[model samples]
Target: MQHKVIIAGGGTGGHIFPAIAIANALKKIAPEIEILFVGARGKMEMEKVPQAGYKIEGLDIAAFNRSNMLKNLTLPFKIIKSLNQASSIIKRFQPNAVVGVGGYASFPMLWKAQRKGIPTLIQEQNSFAGKANKQLGRRANRICVAYDGMEKFFPSDKLILTGNPVRSSITQSAVTRQEALMHFGLQDGKKTVFAFGGSLGAKSISEALRNILPQFVEKDVQLIWQTGKLYHDTAKAAAVPYASHVKVFDFINLMDFAYKASDVVISRAGAMTIAEECLVKKPVIFVPYPYAAEDHQTFNAQALVSKKAGLLIKDSEVGKELGTTLFSLLQNKALIDQLEQNIEKLGNSNADMVIAKEVVKLMG
Candidate 1:
C-alpha cells in the first residue's frame, strides 16, 4: 500500500498554501501516495483544497474568541464536537502520519492523531509558536520551523529548521518587472512601491495611502497597492486622480507579478508574507498587526530587522509616519540594495521539500 498522510489546518492563505506545498512535495517524491486534508467546515480550506486537487474533510470547530467573551462561551461544546468529528475522520482516512500547520482547526485533528498513536508532524510558520502548535509540539514526532532558536518554543531534539513551505508556483516563478507592470496595466520605467495589508486589507495602511496619493504622483513613483477588501473602494477612489500612476485592488491573485515589478514594498508583517519577501529579495517596510496572537507579527518583522534585512513600522504609526518613511526609503537606492541583499540571504526555496522528506522518513 502507498503512504497515506493527512494535512490539517487553514483559515488563511498563510496556512493553506504551506499545507498544499508540503502535500505536493510528498507527491513528487512518491507519486502514488494518498493525501487527505482536514480543515474547519466553513473555512477557506474547503474551497482551496479542492482547487488544489486534494480530497478533504471538514470538522465543525471554532476557536476561543479573545475579543468577545460571550463568543467563547460556546467554544467548549464546539471543541468537543470537533474532536469527535476528527476521530471519525482519522479512523476512516487511516493516514500513516499527520501534518499540522497552525490554525484553530488543526488542534482537534492533530490531537486526535497523537492519541491514536500515529506519527504527527508540525510546521510552525511563526517566530512565536501558537498555543495550538506549542501544545501539539510536545508529542509531535518532528517540528519543522522557518526561523532559528526555536528551542525555546519546542523541544531542541525535535526542531528541524526546514523553513516555511511556499507555493510551488511561487517557488519556481521568475516574474520579471516588465511583465509584472503589464499585469497591473501600469507602465514601466518608474519606481514601483508595492503596498498591501494581506487578503483582508489593513484600514490604517489604506487610510495612510489615501492621504498620500498626491505625494506618490508628485514624486513620479508608480504604486500597486492592495487595500484589503474593506478599504479597496476607498483606496481606488482616492487614487482616481492619479489612476494612471496608481493601481488599487482588494486582492492580488498574481503575487509573483506584483513582487517582480516593485522596487520597494510596504506591507503588514504576516509570517507567510515575510517568507515570500525573502524569496523575492524585495526591500520591505513592515507594519505588524497589533492584534495577532502574542504579537507574533512584530516578532516576525523584528527578527528580519535585527538582521538589517527589512524595516519595521508599527500599525499605529502607519497613520502618522507611513508616507514619510516610504519617501525616505524610496529616495535611497543604496539602502534598498543593501536591504535586498541582506533579505535575499535568508531565502529558503526548498523548505517545503525538506519538511516533506522529514515527515515521510518519520512515517517509515
Candidate 2:
C-alpha cells in the first residue's frame, strides 16, 4: 500500500520552510509516498504550501490572544471548530502518520490523530518547547528536535536530535560573492552587512540600523537590509540619504545571494534563521525578539553564543549597542573566522532526510 502522511503546522517561515524541507526529503527518499499539509486558515502556510506544490487543508484556527483577554472570548469556539475540521481532514486523508511542527493548527490535528490511534511525530524547532508541543508530546511516537537539552521539555525517550531543516537553496546556492554584491548594486572592496528580522521585519533592528546609517557611510560599510513590509516605507525613506551604501527591501526573494554577498549578518534569532546561517557559515550577531513565547529566541541565540558560534545583543540594547558591537566585530578577522568555523560544525545539511526517515519508521 502507498503510504500517506500529513505534515501539520506553520505560522512563520521558521515552521513553514522546515515543514517544506521535510516534505521534499520524504519525496526524495520514497518516491511513492503521498504527502499533505494542514495549516491554519488565512495564515502564510495556506498560501506558501500551495506554492510549494503540495495540497493543504486549512483549519479555522487562531492562537489565543495573550495581550487582550477580551479577544480570547471566541478562542474556545475557534478551537472546537478547528478540531472538527482537523478530524474531517484526517478521516478523508487517512494518513499513515501525522507530524506536528508547532503552530496554531498543530494542536488540534495532532490531538485528533492521536485520538484515532494513528502514529504521530512532533518536530520541535526551538530550544524551548511551545506549550502545545509539550502537551501533545506525551503520546507522540517520535519527537525530532533541533537543540540539545530538550529533554527538559519532552519525554527523553522519544527525543531525537536531527537539527533543523533549512531550504536547499541555502545549502546548494551557486551564487558567488561578486554576483551577489552586483545583484544588490553594492560595490566590492567594502565590508558588507546583511540584516533582517524575519518575514514580518523587526522594528528594533531597523531603528538601530537607521540610527547608524551615517556611521555606515563614514566607515565605508555596505548593507543589504530586509525591513519587512511594516517598516519598509520608513526604512526606505531613511536610506534615501545613503542609497549607495544601503539597499533596503520589504522582503528579499533571493536570500542565498544576500548570504553570499555579506561579510557578516544581523538577524532575529528564529530557529530557521539560525539553521540557515549555520549552513552558510556566516558570523552573525543575533538580536532575539524579547516578546517571543517564553523568551525562546534568547534561548536559541544562547545555544550558539555559549559555544562561541554566534553573538547576542538583547532586543532592548539594539539601539544603544548594536552599531558599536557590529563595527568592532567587523574589524576582527580572527574572531570572524572562529565564529564561521564553529557555526559550520553545527550545520546539519541532512536534517530533513533524517527526519524523513524517522517519519517513515513511525509509519511502519
Candidate 3:
C-alpha cells in the first residue's frame, strides 16, 4: 500500500530545503509513497516545492508581524480560514502523516491533523524552539530536532535529535576543488572565500563585502559571493574593479560547486547553513542574524564555536570585524585545518534518512 504524507514549511531556504530532503528520503525508501507540501500562499515554498516535483497546497495564512504590531490584527481570522482550508485538504488527500517543519503555514495544518487524531510530526531546525512549535509539541507525536537540550521546550520522550536534513547533493557532494574553481572561472591555487547570508542577502554582510572588495583583490584571494537579490546590483558594481578576482551572483543554484571551491566560508548561522558547513568540512565564520526568533542563529553558531568547530561574530560587528577576521583566518592554515576536522565530526550526513525512517515508524 502507498503511504501518503504531507510535509509543511518554508519561509526560507533553511526550512524548504530540509522539507524537500525529507520528502526525497521518503521516496527513496518507499518509491510508491505519495507526498504533498503545504506552505504560505505567496512564499518561496509555493514555487520551490513544485520545482522539486511535488504538488503543494497554499494557505491564506500570515505570520504574526513582529516588526509591525498592527499588521497582526487579522492574524486570527487568517488562521481560522487556513484551518478550514487545511481540513478540506486533509479530508481529500487522506494523508497517513502530516509533518510540520516550522512556518506559519505548518501550524494550521499540523494543528488540524493532531485534532483529527492523525499522526503529526514537527521538525524544529533551530537550537531555540519557535513559539508555534512549542505549542504544537503538546500534541505532536514526534518532535524532530537538530540540537540537543531541546527538552526544555518539548517533552523528552517525544524529542528525537536527527540533526537538520540537508539536500542530498550537499551531503554527498563529489565535485573537486579544481572542477568547482573552473566552474566559477577562478584559478585553482588561489585562496577562495564563499560567502552567502542565506537565501535573502543580508544587508550587513553585503555592505561589509562591498567595503572590502578592493582588499580581496590586493590579497590575491578569489571570491564566490551569493549576494541574494537585494544586494546583487550593489555587489556587482562593487566587484567591477576586482572582477577577475570575484564571481558574484544574486543566488548560486550550484551550491555543491560553491562548497567544493571554498577554502573558507562566511555565512549566516541559520540551522541549515550550519548543517551544510559541517558536512562540507570547511572552516566557517558565522554572523548570526540577530533578529532571528529568540536569536536562535547565535545559539546555533555558539554550539560549534564552543567546540572550536567554527568562529562567530555579532551581526553588529560585521563592518568593523568581518573583513579583517576573514582575511586573518585565510592566512591561518593550522587553525583552518583544526576547524575543518572538528566541524566534520559534527555533521550527520544521513539525517534525512534517519528522519524518514522515524516518520514511517511513527505513522505506522
Candidate 4:
C-alpha cells in the first residue's frame, strides 16, 4: 500500500524549502509514496511547491496580526474556517502521516490529523520554538528539531536532533571558486562579498548598500548581492554606477555557485541561511531581523557570535553598524578564517534525509 504524506506550512523559503527537502527524501525512499502540500493561500509555497513538482492545496488562512492588534479580530474566524478546510482536505487525502515545517496553515491541518488519531511530525527550524509548534508538541508523535537545548520546548524523549536540511545543490557541493566566479562574471583576483536580506528583502540593508556601493567599488571588491524581490529595482537603480563591481539579483537559485564564489557574506540570520552558511563554512556578518518569531533570528546569530562563528548586528542597529561590520570582516582574513572554522563545526547538511528516515520509522 502506498503511504500518503502531507507536508504543510510556508510563508518564507525557510519553511517551504525544508518541506521540499523532506519530500525529496521521502520519494527517494519510496518512489510509490504519495505526497501533497498544504500551504497558506497567498504564500510563496503556492509557487515553490508546484515548481518542485509536488501537488499542493492552499488554505485561506493568516497568522494573527502581531504588528497591528486590531487586525487579529478576524483571526478567530480565519482559524475556524481554516480548520474546516483542513479537515476536508485530510479526509480526501487520508494521509498516513502529516509533517509540518512551521507556518500559518500548519496548525489547523496538523491539529486535525492528531484528532483523527493519525501520526504527525513537526520540524521546528528555529532555536526558539514557535508558539504554534510549542502547542503542537504535546500531541506530536515526533518532533524533529534543528537545534540542541530544545528540551525546554518539547518533550526530550520525543525530540530528535536532526540538523536542518540545506538545498541539495549546496549539500552535495563541488562548485569550485573558479567556476563560481566565472558564473558571476567576476575576476578571480578580486575579493567577492555576498549579500542577501532573506527572500522578502530588508529595507534597511538595501539602503545601507546604496551608501556603501561606491566604497566597495573603490576598494576593488566584487559583490553578489541578492536584494530580496521587493527592492530589486530600487537597489539596481541605486547601484548602477558600480555595476562593474556588482551582480545584483532578486534571487539566486544557484546558491552553491553563489556561496563558492564569495569570500565574505553579509546576510540575515534566518535558520536556513545560518545552516547554509555553516555548511559552506563562510565568514558572515549577520543582520538579524528583529521581528522574527520570538526575535529568534537574534538568538540564532548570538549562538554564532558566542562561538565566534559569525558577527551579529541587530536589524534596528543596521543603519549605523551594517556597513562598518561588513567592512571589518571583509578586510580581516584572520577573523574570516576563525569564523569559517568555528561555524563549520555546526554544519549537518544531511539532516533532511535523517529527519525523513526517522519520520518513516515512526510511521511503521
Candidate 5:
C-alpha cells in the first residue's frame, strides 16, 4: 500500500519552507506517497504550502498569549476545536504517519495523531525548544532537531540531529554574482551587502541601516535590503534618494539570486536563514530577535559564532554597532574567506533526504 503522510505546522517561512522540503524529499523517495499539510488558519503556511503544490487543511488555532492574560481565555476553546477538526481530518485521510513542524497548529494535530496510535514525528528547528515542542516531545515517536544539544529538552532516545532543511533552490543555487546583480539592476565592481530580518522585517535593523545609508554610499558599498512588510514604506522612501546605491523591497521572492549577489549577509538568526547561509557559504552577521522563545535566535547564532563561522550583534546593540562592524568586515577579504570556509563545513545539504528516509522507516 502507498504511504500517506500528514505534515503539520507553520506560521513563518522557517517552518513552512522546511515542511515543504520534507514533503518534496518524501515524494522523491516514493513518487506515489501522499502528503498533506495542516496549518493554522490565516497563517502564511496556508498560502505558502499551496504554492509549493501541496494540499493543506487549516485549523482555527492560535498561540497562547504571554503578555495578555485575557487573550488566552479563548485559547483552550480554540485548541479543543482544533483537536476535533484534526481528528476528523486524520480519520478521513488515514495517514500512515504524522509529522509536526513547530507552529500553533502542531500541538493539536500531533495530539490527535498520537491519540489515534499513529506514528508521529516532531521537527524542532530552534536551538532552544519552545514550550509546545517540549510538551509534544513526550508523545512524539521521533524528535528531529537542527541543533546538537537538544537532549537538554527531549529524551535522548527520541532526539535525532538532522540539520534544518533549506529550500532546494537555495541549497543548490547556481546563480552567479554577475547574474544576480544584473537581476537586481545593481552595478558590478562594488561589494554588495544583503540584509533581511525574516519575512516580517526587523525594525531595529531597518532603522540602523537607514541611518547608515549615507555611510554605505560614501564607502561605495551597495546594498540589497529586504525591509519586510512592516518597514516597507519607510525603507522605500529612505532608499528613494539613493536608488543607485541601494535596492530595497518589502520581500524578495528570488532569494537564491539575492544570496548569490551578496558578498556579506546581515540577517536574523532564524534556523532556516542560518541553514541557507551555511549552504551559500557567505560571511554573515546575525542580529537575533530578543523575543524569540528563550532567546533561541541568539543560541542559533552562537553555534556559528563559536566556530568562527558567523558574527553576532544583539538587537539592542544594532544601532550602536551594526554599521561599523559591517564596514570593517567588508574591507577584510581574509576574514570573509575564513568565514565562508568555516560556514561551508557546517552545511548539511542532505537534511531533507535524511528526514524523509527516517519517516519512511518509522512508517514501516
Candidate 6:
C-alpha cells in the first residue's frame, strides 16, 4: 500500500520553510509517498504551502489573544470549529502518519490524529517548546527537535536532535562573494554588513541602524538592509545620505546572494534565521524578540552564545548597544573568523533528510 502523510502547521517562515524542507525530503526518500499539508486559514501557510506545490487544507483556527482579552471571546468557538475541520481532513486523507511542525493548526490536526491512533510526530524548532507542541508531545510517536535539553518539554525517549531544516538554497549556494557584491551594487574592498528582521521587519533594528548610518561611511562599510515592508519607506529615506554604500529593501528575494556578500550579519533570533546563519557560517549578532513565547528567541541565541558561535544583544538594548557591538565586531577579523568556525560546526545540512527518515519509520 502507498503511504500517505500529513504535515501540519505554519505561521511564520520558521515553521513554513522547515515544513516544506521535510516534505521535499520525504519525496526524495520515498518517491511513492503521498503528502498533504494542513494549515490555519488566512495564515501565511495557506499561500506559501500551495506555492511550494503541495495540497493544503486550512482550518478556521486562531491563536488565543494574549494582549487583548476581548479579542479571545471567539477563540474557543474557533478552536471547536477547527477541531471538526481537522477531523474531516484526517478522515478523508487517512494519512499513515501525521507530522506537526508547530503553529496554530498543528494542535487541532495532531490532536485529532492522535485520538484516532494515527502515528504522529512533532517538530519542535525552538529551544523552549510552545505550549501547544508541549501538550501534543505526550502522545506523539517521535519528536524532532533543533535544540538540546528539550526533555523538560517533551518525552525524553521521543526526542531526536535533528536540528532545524533550513532552505537548501542557503546551505548549498554557489554564489561567489564578488558576484554577490555586484548583485547588490556595493563597492569592493569594503567590509559589508547585512541586516534583516524577518518578513514584517523589526522597528528596533531599523531604528538603530538609522541612528548609526553615518558611522558606515566613516568606517568604509557597505550594507544590504532588508527593512521589511513596514519600515521600508522610512529606512530608504534615511539611507539617502549614504545611498552609494547602502542598499535598502523591504524584502530580499535573493538571500543566498546576500549571505555570500556579507562579512557580518544582524538579525532577529528566529529559529529558521539561526539555522540559515549557521549554515552560511557568517558572523552574526542576534537581537532576540523579547515578546516571543517564553522568550524563546533569547534561549535560541543563548545556545549559540554559550558556544561562542554568535553574539546576543537584547531587543530592548538595541538602541544603546547595537552600534558599538556591530562596529567592534566588524573591525575584528580574528573574532569574526572564530565565530564563523564555531557556528559552522552547529549547522546540520541533512536535518530534513533525517527527520524524513524518522517519519518514514513511524509509517512502517
Q: Could you estimate the TM-score for every candidate?
A: 0.98, 0.99, 0.98, 0.96, 0.97, 0.99
Clashing pairs in model 1, backbone N/Cα/C closer than 3 A: 201-228
Candidate 2 per-residue lDDT over residues 84-170, each given as its tens digit? 999999889999999998888899999999999999999999999988999999999999999999999998999999999999888
Assess the local accuracy of residue 245 in candidate 6 as a C-alpha lDDT between 0 and 100: 84
TM-score of structure candidate 3: 0.98
Return whichever of 5 and 6 wins on TM-score. Answer: 6
Task: Output the worst ten-in-a-row residue range by lDDT, candidate 1.
Answer: 168-177
CA lDDT of each candidate? 0.90, 0.95, 0.92, 0.89, 0.93, 0.94
Candidate 4 regions with alpha-carbon error over 4 angstroms: none
How would you encode candidate 6's per-residue C-alpha lDDT over 142-171 as one tens digit per residue? Answer: 999988899999989999999999878887
Worst 10 residues of 5 by lDDT: 168-177
lDDT of 1 by residue, 43-97 (tens): 9999999999999899888777888999888889999999999899888888899
Which candidate number would show the highest lDDT if scored against the true structure? 2
lDDT of 1: 0.90
Predicted structure 3: lDDT: 0.92
Per-residue lDDT, model 2, residue 76, is 93
Which residue pairs in candidate 6 collide?
Answer: none
Q: Residue 189 in model 6: shift from native, Å?
A: 1.7
For model 3 the local lDDT of residue 261 reads 95
Report the C-alpha lDDT of model 4 over 1-364, residue by residue, as the tens digit: 7788999899989999889999999999888889999999989999999999999999989987778999999988999999999999999999999999999989999999999998999999989998999999999999998787999999999999898988887888887899999998889989899888887778878788877899888889998999888889998898889999988999887988999999998899999999899999999888889888799998888878999999987777877887788877788889988999999999997898898887687678
The deviation in Å at residue 76 for candidate 1 is 0.3
lDDT tens readout by residue for model 5, 52-134: 99999999999877789999999888988999999999999999999998988888888888889999999899889988889
